[model samples]
Target: MTKKAQTPAVQNGNTDPNTLQLHKDPAQTDAAQIAAMALGSVAANAMTARTFAKGTFGTLDVTECVMTLKQRVDTTHDGNLKHAETTLTAQAAALDAIFNEMARRAALNMGEYLEATERYMRLALKAQGQCRATLETLAGIKNPPVIFAKQANIAHGPQQVNNDSFPSSTRIRAHARKRGTTPDELLEGPQHGSTNMDDRAATTPTRGHPAVETLEPIHWPRKPRRKSGGGA
Candidate 1:
């Protein structure tokens, strides 16, 4: 008796052999897989530490070298980031060179002698785009986006935000409490007469900027209208 040929697994009732089939490699055993993963992890960690050391050698401070292991880990992180930035910049330079060469070739091919103008031109365009994208990526990697939870509020109305680390009001209040005085007095500087807390509390000092002095609204005088004469 002859063994029948087995067909590849079909998907959605289709007989296409090109369809992808997901399965573990038959040659890779459980132990082999685990060992490979462990080896990869070890290699990655070694590379990271090596890169960190290379980056930190010239710039490493005595305090950073002698401090807690956690600080060393943090320095390692900075070193790694610096390495990444350096790598990205070098890659961008390489890409720029590649793009320039490709562009030159494309320009050369566009003439009467070269037959592969379209192909070279297309490749050059692609290279230029890739170069631009890589530089953009490098820029982003160098200066990552900063998320500001609170920003300076320059607009009008009650909605205001403080961007300072320590607010002036808080500092003033703290000093006032320490010196046995009101926040208003601290703000006004050395004054002979003390201001009433009731008056200060009654007036809201421009919500966001507490240090800014509030000015009274200017009242403009209106001009009188001339009376019209009938049939002049």
Candidate 2:
């Protein structure tokens, strides 16, 4: 009798320890993949945070880096608004100083050096414009601009269309009726004795000229012609 084939030692329903283990539960495998992805994401975010914080003086660990990455400017926060206001104030002050210096140079060179005065005044004007722009920016930051966009309503239902052959005819008739006149007469417009200036000039007499005068053709005098002959 052949001896019964002996099976290798099985652990957790696996035939061999060296063989790759097949995950029976899809959920477990997915969970492991998700965990790895999460770890990689955290590392990436931490690296980005490190790069962002590189020039800063303070030292930050992974936790601090993650926290910093999570932080964002809160528009509704008072502290953020105050910080922005302070920064704008500082910039405005710096611009004001530049403007004052340029103005002083311009005034100093006014009578003595025309070119220098012009150049300095031009620079001062530029600085003044920048300061004004900065102040305007600060004001905008304090109270943000509100834009009003007019919303147009579209009609989706059945629309009433006017299919009148002559759109103005009805209005003309109604207006003529209100004036107690026929539409044809109203359309003929105001009655005039003469239609145009030429007719009026022909029909009416001028200050010195009589009306209905006939103009005759002008006759120029003919020059006398000599008989052709050989000259002696």
Candidate 3:
């Protein structure tokens, strides 16, 4: 039996930049959202003595409470980092490929030049949007500063995305003396070599960044347009 070769997707005279669509990977986004939910759950459970009350009879342990924060930061920070890196890196690669393809097309016939240039513009805009999204996702990891903040929780801000239900560092410290620990030791960010969630870059607060941009746009080789002439 003879097998036929697949036909090329593009046919002549059907050049349309808008027809090309960007394929986004939902896996990264899905992972990030699920991680967020899990992180949130962990934080909510760690905020109180309810879980510990069963064993300690309502005794508040500062180290124990701080451990909860550590766990929360670790999970959230790590997940956010994974999502950010995967998402941004993928977007950058996609944009780069698109630009190259568009550039190749622009160097061909007249119609293709226009179509490819338009697509190139659209790609730039898409890249910018992705960059902003990347920034937002990274911020969701924890405090944006934590990604690059000074060591020892120097950049550990009091704010959190889903940690409203958790106790404040001040309260945790106030109750620490009762448990033979200091607040600084507890709230000073995740302990090094402690949890798998310790990513120095992910813990820092930072704006979301895009993986692609105008750099991906290819310069079109201008083609000459024929002038109208009257028949003699």
Query: Best by lDDT, which number?
Result: 2
Mind giving the per-residue lDDT tens digits that candidate 3 earns over 1-232? 8754233233433233112122245666856755654466543465454344534443333334445556656866766466445666677667556656655554553465676667666665666566566656655554554456543433467754324466777667758878766755533334454443434434655769856656677899999998779775
Candidate 3 Cα lDDT to native = 0.53
What's the lDDT for candidate 1?
0.58
Ordered by TM-score, highest first, the candidates read 2, 1, 3
lDDT of 1 at 192: 36
TM-score of each: 0.34, 0.35, 0.22
* C-alpha lDDT of all candidate models, in order: 0.58, 0.63, 0.53
Predicted candidate 1, C-alpha RMSD: 20.6
Greater-lDDT candidate between 1 and 2:
2
Tens-place lDDT per residue, model 2, 1-232, is 9754333222244444223232355657876755653576554676565556545633335444443333524342435666667777888888888888988998999899989999988888888888888889889988888999965545689764344554766677778789887754523334544445334344645678557877898899997898679876
Stretches of candidate 1 above 4 Å error? 1-79, 113-115, 149-232
Q: Once model 2 is optimally superposed onto the true structure by TM-score, how far is the C-alpha of residue 213 displaced, in angstroms?
A: 32
Q: What's the candidate order when arranged by decreasing lDDT?
A: 2, 1, 3
- Which scores higher on lDDT, 2 or 3? 2
Which candidate wins on TM-score?
2
Tens digit per residue, CA lDDT, model 1, 150-211: 55457677763544575777676767889887755444433534364343556645767458
Off by over 4 Å in 2: 1-79, 154-232
TM accuracy, model 2: 0.35
